[model samples]
Target: MISRDCLQQSSLMAYKNVYQLLGVAFIVGLASGRALKADEDASPRIGIIGGGIGGTSTAFFLRQLYGPKLTIDVFEAQKVGGRTSLIRVNGEDYEAGGTIIHKKNIIYEFQDKGMAFTTTEDMLRAMGDDLLNMTRHTMNESLQHIGLSQRFIDEFAAAAVKDNYGQTLNAHGFLGVVSLMAVEPDLWAIQDGNKRMAELLLRESKANLIKGSVNTVALIKDNLGTGSVSYELDYTKATPGSDKETSESREYDIVVVAAPLNEGSKNKISFADFPRDVVTFKQDYHKLISMFVQGKVNTTAFDVGSQNELPAEIISIAPGCFFNSLKKMTPVSPNSKPDTPLKPEEAVWRVFFNKDPTEEEINNLFVSHSDLRLVDWWAYPEYQAGADLPPFMLYDRLYYVNAVEAAASAMETALIGGRNVALLAYNQWHGHFDKIDEVQLPSPAENEETKKSEL
Candidate 1:
């Protein structure tokens, strides 16, 4: 069996190699053939579907690559933060969706130059074979193979998956690793809410936030004999006052679908005049319910002597348990001071469940409550071991950001996916084929040798 340290070192080396190649690509500005017609007087127009982390981050990276001259439009029907959102409880806002972020997540490395110039496949390949092999097995098998004790896998590992994904050890190993990362030290979240990341990325990208849901993306042939192709998007925006939706259409040089194009997804943007189906697989998302209740702990139900005996968080492994986990929540605002010693009756708790809890079940979990709010989410992909991952490119000049969710779904992964799609688009537009789908990168030692040779 390979040592854990060896595996970590290998993954780190792989990441370094990939990033180094990307830096070189950005510096050289290599071009083989241009996909979009170059017009000095006209800047390329881009349309992005969804206003979530993936979409917003794609816009941000596109701005970084294409500069401020490009026009970008982001379409969102309801809110800017898609799955990362908030809910009100007892007149205070609390996170209802994605919460903690791992310290090692790439989100913190946003300041690194040339970090986003790679495809999803290339990025995953750079993580080394050991970590990539995790995608081919169940979490149970992968952890056991990695020399983790069964006791730890059953208790700690199970709890992590249950709490983060609302799934058991049967989940794919890659996502299980992602779940375990959540428990790592130095994990943090935004002061107000995680959704602020999306809002701020959108603002920084300077993209127009269109209030509507995109319905169709059709390939528009160049009837003017310019041999250039564009995509037309048809969307519907709610009328100002009355109960009506105004339909509108627009054309763009490139389009990025930042949301999932799966069976249960709300976005139903169809592809027209394409050579083949955009996405051939029948993918589905897992349903998770986040229930927030401001209430007292039912100590007796937990077999505890008193409320103080109960921990702030509870992870249940029993198959009969209706909920995955229960955790005490803090206010969204960092300025608000939570009462010390947290009076059991005054605390706000978030309970994750695969299904809605019955009134009796709720009563059994909590003694009393003043406010209760529930947010149902098609949270993530129904991950299956050995399942084929989706592609970053859907069609020429058309990309999908949520394809990375097939391996693991998290805020950081969403951002990574967004950056990848943006890079793929940029590379294809600028004819930088050398940077796309690169199979291997030179080792650090090789890079140093080449530098010495050049000197």
Candidate 2:
């Protein structure tokens, strides 16, 4: 079925045809944005897959670059925003997976929103006395009190200090080495530890999003005579199909791919091998389950999982499992809310566990006590090993841009990477271009299969 957006596209009418149809050219005149007929022959056709930030921004910018010299259509496999996802559940418009931004993330601070979006600094400035804590004492930004109970705070702090290295050690073979490396908590860091982890996969994990699955499936060129490319999309969450079941396709003179590297790994949706980039990911990406428990009192994050129940303010650094918990907790005392006599729903005490979790073990880990009840859970793959934007031309028109192979996986980094991909495509099409380096992610047909299941 055609979408409601049909009002947006108009069948192209030639220059003289307009005057011929209207029976007047001088009157319809030079003020019209129309170009002379000779310009028509040069218009390029372009198509895109994955309507996330990368795709959307590329379209918007492409319009700016080409004006009436080109036509572009984006073929998305899911909602408009790709990995920077979003959702509405139970009437609570909360982000599920990708969320949060730092003040240093200037790229987001200046994007389409125009208004400087909220940052960690924005929250602190809003609090009058809270500002006092920040100014009155020299404090580690990560260690600031976030409405954690003294008990939780102590536990979290102690865990952070451990030399456990947090690496999974249960591997049995060559894959085991990577599985172990992939699971190391330090690898998720934006610096030296797992610097590439953030560059390749973690960036999207930091954006505000309502997470869900999405994919792009290429099909036999629908407009082969017109030199076009298209895709068969399964938006209703259908199981993927083999060659015979494929249908539909988008057409383009050039295709710039700027989505994550997707191979046929248990974690990836695309089944074919990418034509470029041959390095294999350590393992199929793993799943991440996060428990965002909203209410708790006297339980400082540092104490929740640590041996000492110190005041939250005393912890040297924040725990990795938590997402600035103070935001989840309500400021009023638990007895103050009208109907429920709410507790600290404002503190955002949370934890992330991966595929290695034994069912009984994680259940015990998330079980909320009187001081804390597990209120929310976000389960999804911990995006890893996404490859970068491929070269400008794929068979002269097919372009690939995936984000799993960067050195740091942050939202801004992905956006920058995406911009690079879009610019590369634009230049190769006609505009001034730069030499974008080529990086290849995984593909199912050309690589080993991962053991992960959809569940």
Candidate 3:
């Protein structure tokens, strides 16, 4: 005779197990079905643009869903990890881009069958009224409505947003919650660097990596009068040991654009022969500069008596501050060990700035420095409160992974978006309409009854 609380918990577990089994059944059904738009002997051809976390993770999920026979091609213009990169200072590397991962991030559960492939409307409905209303207000207003004191919002909350996004508390409430999560104690990062995740995902997916910049994507209609449509990608690759580039084109049954389609984007991929514009409204990206310096701290400047009195991390609430945050960093390599009780006087510090710091500003922060490196990045979107989120599905058989960035931008969110697009593409191709935009879950009592019936 279990207690009522224990029985309820058991029922919840049964419900989750039942949902997982249903998802497994759905996958088995897809496996038994014929491949969509492919010759009976061949598998579907998938082309993904950008080799960032979003693109690489999408390839990984597609491989898991479609099995080994599927052909996946990943195109990257620069480094594979995109914004997740590293910078070296004094012979040691530090995270220059995406730094931390929260404990609540669902990257490990990406293969779960209960996942839903959803659109913007579906996402709003799934969030329910309370969470949906938060998106319509600024972070300050949202937090205030939740009964938080104004001082906490102005100091700690503002500092979190400033340190994470280089923005103030006026950002969207949804992303503000994300920013606050970054400061949680459960946060951790990859051992060597976060970029390694992207590299490993690409390698595990067994995708052919195409090293080139895609310039244009055009719709190809009825090749050989088969009444089947495909996409043609025009790209340019640099010739080795020469100041020249070669142009090439390839066709694929499905295409995924993993990069941001913003007006300020460097990857100018134009859409050709489409009935309408692929992306109409203009979105701008925010610029962030990560400066790494190896030097002693100016204890006096921070109103501290000595190096031991200085904080390991400093977050600024003052608007006139030159930098957003300054932090003492550890080596990217997990094997390497630092001296016990780190000396702030002799350490590597990472300083984040919305703009480049002047020489005077650098001198004021540090008494002296031996080495310095700076990395400029078009990190994330310029988030606005009450802005409409972009659609994941751009057109038939075409998807955009970065559309999720409008709500929040992080390594975990990027992987989630990638998985969502992969599922969306697979479901749409195989006519699995039942799996898309599903907003309801069965009650615990119903699941318990079903569990007993099955037994």
- The 10 consecutive residues of candidate 1 with the worst lDDT sum are 11-20
Comparison by TM-score, 1 against 2, better one: 1
Candidate 1 pairs with clashing backbones: none
Best by lDDT: 3
The TM-score that candidate 3 achieves is 0.84
**What pairs collide in candidate 3?**
none
TM-score of each: 0.84, 0.45, 0.84
Candidate 2 CA-lDDT value: 0.34
Predictions: Cα RMSD each: 9.1, 21.1, 10.9
Q: What is the lDDT of candidate 3?
A: 0.75
lDDT of 3 by residue, 17-128 (tens): 1011111232233235432233234367999999999999889778767778899999999999998988876666778899877654432242254345555445544555
Per-candidate Cα lDDT values, in order, are 0.74, 0.34, 0.75
Model 1 alpha-carbon miss at residue 395, Å: 0.7
* Candidates 1 and 2, the one with greater lDDT: 1
- Candidate 2 regions exceeding 4 Å error are 1-42, 86-91, 102-246, 264-286, 297-341, 345-348, 356-395, 403-405, 431-455
